[model samples]
Target: MTRKQRVLFLCRDNATLSILAEALLRELDGLHFDAFSAGLEPADRVHAAALGELRHGFSSLDLLNPKSWLEFTSEWAPEMDFVVTLCDESARVDVRAFHGTPKLRHWTLTPSAHGATHAIENAFWQILKRVEDFIAAERRPWPSSLKLPAVASCTTDACDLLLSGQ
Candidate 1:
C-alpha cells in the first residue's frame, strides 16, 4: 500500500485558519494524507466563529486545541511530508525547514480583523475548497526513495475517500 502524506498547517495563532485547514483535511480521510496544525504563537482557544464554520465540513475531533510548532520538532511528533502556512505572517517567516525535511507551501489568507462572523466563515470555506483542490491535483504514486514511517500507508485510501465524497 502507498504511504499516507503527512501535512502540517501553520498560522500565527493556530486558532482560526490553521485549525480550519487541519479539520477539513482530516475529514478528507486516510487515502491521501493526514494533517496537523500549529502556531508560532498559539492562542488559548480557537475562534468560536471558525469552529462553527468547520462543523459544516468536518467532525469536531479534527479541530485541535492550540499548539506550538516546537512540538512537531520533538521526538514524539509525527514526521510530516508537507508543511503549509495558511496566514500571511507565517508565510513571511523563513523557518520552513522542520525535522522531517518536509516540503513547504504557502497559502496566504487575509486575517479577519474586521469582517463579520459570517464573512470570516465564508473565507475559511473558500480557503478549504482551494486546499482540497490542491490535494486532488497533487495525488501521485508514493516513491520508494522517501524514508517514510509505517503510518503513511493510509494516504491513498484516505485521499481517495475524500475526493470521492466531494
Candidate 2:
C-alpha cells in the first residue's frame, strides 16, 4: 500500500482558518492524508465558532486544538509532503525550507472578526471548498515530470497544479 501523504496548514493564529482546514481535510480524506495545522503565533484556545461548527459537522473534535508552528519543526515531527499557508500573514513569513522539502501553496483567506457568526461561517465554507479541491488534486493521476505553474489563486485547476510541484 502507498504511504499516506502528510499535509500541514498554517495561518497567523491557529484559532480559526487553520483549525478548520486541518479538521476538514482529515474528515474529508484521512485515509490518504495525515492533516495538521499550526500558527505562527498560536492563540490560547481554538475559536469558539470554529470549534462549534466543526462539532456540528464532524464526528470527532480530537484534532481541533490550536498549536504553534514550532511543533512541526522538531526532528520527531512527521515530514510533510505539503505545507499550505491559509492567510496572507502566514504566507508572508519567510522561513527556511521544511523537512522533506514539502511543496508549498498559499491560499489567501480573510479572517472573520471575533464573534462574527456570519463571517466565520463564510470562512468555514471557503476552507471546506479549498480542502475538497486539494484532495481532488492529490488524488488525480498526472505525469510526475509535468509540473504546473504555481498560481496564487485557489481555483480548482490552480490547486491541482500547485500540488503537482510548480
Candidate number of the best lDDT: 2
* Residue 147 displacement in candidate 2 (angstroms): 31
lDDT of candidate 1 over 29-148, digit per residue (tens): 546788889999999998888888766646555447899988887778887888888777777655544666788888755555324776666667667786778678766666577673
lDDT of 2: 0.82
lDDT of 2 by residue, 1-166 (tens): 3578889999988998888999999899888888999999999998888888898768658767889898898888888888999877788755454677788889866555334766888888888989999998986333377665655669887778667866
Candidate lDDT scores, in order, read 0.76, 0.82
Separately for all candidates shown, the number of backbone clashes (residues 3 or more apart, or on different chains) is 11, 0
Candidate 2 clash pair list? none
Clash number for model 2? 0
Can you give the TM-score per candidate against the true fold? 0.73, 0.77
Alpha-carbon RMSD to native, per candidate: 11.6, 13.6
* Model 2 weakest 10-residue run by lDDT: 139-148
